[model samples]
Target: MAFASYPSLRDKVVFVTGGASGIGATFVSEFHAQGSKVAFVDLSEDEGRALSGKLAGSWFRRCDVTDAFALQSAIRDAAEALGPITVLINNVANDTRHDAASVTPEQWRKALAVNLDPAMVASVAVYPMMKQAGGGSIVNVSSINAIWGPGHMPAYVAAKGAINSLSKGLGREWGPDRIRVNALSPGWVITPRQLELWLTPEAEAEWSKLVALKDRLMPEDIARMAMFLAADDSRMITGQNFIVDAGRL
Candidate 1:
């Protein structure tokens, strides 16, 4: 499907976390297609390098977002490579399911670190850059699992819920600086990881029955909403959760 182009996004600086594959990859590609200067970081070095090469002028750095210091350093390096990041897409997350009964303290902490902490740390690291640029947009990728109260992966749900809350708080905190922050919640996007790990025939049929739209969501579906949030089209929108869930919620 052809999507509308945002003239405001032309030449804007964009940074995305976990942009080597899946939904995050779409964010990097879409922003680049819109003429934004894109720099992205991911743990998958090979995929990241390939994607960066595919999109000329885009920068790719290997970063594990769980490490707060490393994440901050990556943001700095991305800014240096692509100028101050005026559009930050906090899209890194690990949704590996674990039995609540078997979840240890360390496991819980790791889940939060991967799914939640980076969003906050990355936003903090880029605040000055965004402010100095006059204004900017931050889109925190969340999930419908947080709102649906799904069973299994309790830590993932908790972390995503925290992300939604953090987005709201940062939106208010930085609004005066002309910075906008919003949470983008997606439902059942069929990425390669999901197809490999979770998208069984039974699961797909059940989810299809629940969503208002018959078609399953894709990475580009979520990316389109993100692009709008990052562009001037959403200049007045902030502190809200934008769900691209086919009306499941």
Candidate 2:
């Protein structure tokens, strides 16, 4: 399917976290297709480099988003290499599964570090640039699990829950500056990681039975919503949680 293009996105600087693969990588490619100057960082150096090479003029860096300093530095470097980032996609996340009963204090901290902290850190890093640009969009990649509360992954659910509130709080605080903050929640997007780690036929069948849309949710499907949120079309929209979950609630 041919997605609509946004003229405002052309020549804009887009910064994405964890853009080496999965939904984040799709964001990098899709924004680049819209002629946005894309700069992405991921821990996967080889994949990041390959993606950057595939898209001429795109920038890639190896960054572990858990490290607040490293994440901030990467954003700064991306801005310097490209330009002031007007679109920041906080797409870095690790929804690692674990039993809630077995979770330790360190494990809880680690989960928040990976899933919750980076969104705030990255958004803070780009605040000045967006302010100077007069306006910008910040799309925090959250999950429907934030609301669903599937008990198997308690930490992930908690972190994502925070993301929703974080987006709203940030939106309220920064809306006066014209920096819009919103959360993009995806439900069971079949990415490489999900395919490798989970997507068995039996599991897929069970998931299909639950969602309103029977088809598989691809990365581009989620990326397109993000593009709209980042573009001028969503100028009046802010502080909301958009679930691209195919009627999963």
Candidate 3:
């Protein structure tokens, strides 16, 4: 007799929002490796399609998470093409840092819609699907700034804080359904773009001072934790925010 396989996301269907780049892209790739049929959404048609082409078990759709109706439609289509979505990763957000006091009201609203509203809509959309699948996981990608109260990103901070609270509340509300909800908050992982455009010597010095790990954190580092959460290894974990900040408080 053949031994049973034990991949955490084996045969599960996962949908990731804003998975075109950064940490979101890593999530998509990691899940695909775990034997899950993964689908992701992004507004960048070229990048999204290219990623889909490269990944064996992945689907990509052009979607703007801020539009609830569009998101709903995209989710439905992804489900139809793939299978019932057992894992939902709400990771889409535009983090264009700006001076809070100078940001226009419209821009603030746009930021919140992209960062916070997508969490609500994505979670809500997957409720029935997860229920049908006999329970599932919803992992929201938040930021360390949620806890740090970072300056100049007032809107982003507010959105991430709301995501944390929403994660807890939803976990409580959906516990009976066997659906787990949680948040993954990452600290200063030096993405390629950040290094080229923003990471100064002063910033590197500060990072070294704060981080407990001598090695620098990268997108893959955060992706590893997400894989744990997506897998059954974290079956008992829910409503808690897992901070993968390289030991940075």
Per-candidate local distance difference test: 0.94, 0.95, 0.87
| Candidate 3 accuracy as TM-score | 0.95
RMSD of each: 0.9, 0.9, 3.3
Tens digits of per-residue lDDT, candidate 1, 1-249, equal 667999999999999999999999999999999999999999999999999999989999999999999999999988887799999999999999888999999999999989999999999999999999899999999999989878888999999999999999999999999999999999999999999998999999998889899888999999999999999999999999999999783
> What TM-score does each of the candidates earn?
0.98, 0.98, 0.95
Report the candidate with higher lDDT, 2 versus 3.
Answer: 2
User: Which pairs clash (backbone N, Cα, C closer than 3 Å) in model 1?
Assistant: none
lDDT of 3 by residue, 19-109 (tens): 9887788888878877889999999898898888889868888988888999999889999999999899998876778998899999899
The list of candidate 2 runs beyond 4 A from truth reads none
* lDDT tens digits by residue: candidate 2, 5-82: 999999999999999999999999999999999999999999999999999999998998999999999999889989
Instruction: Quantify how close model 3 is to the true structure by its C-alpha RMSD in Å.
Output: 3.3
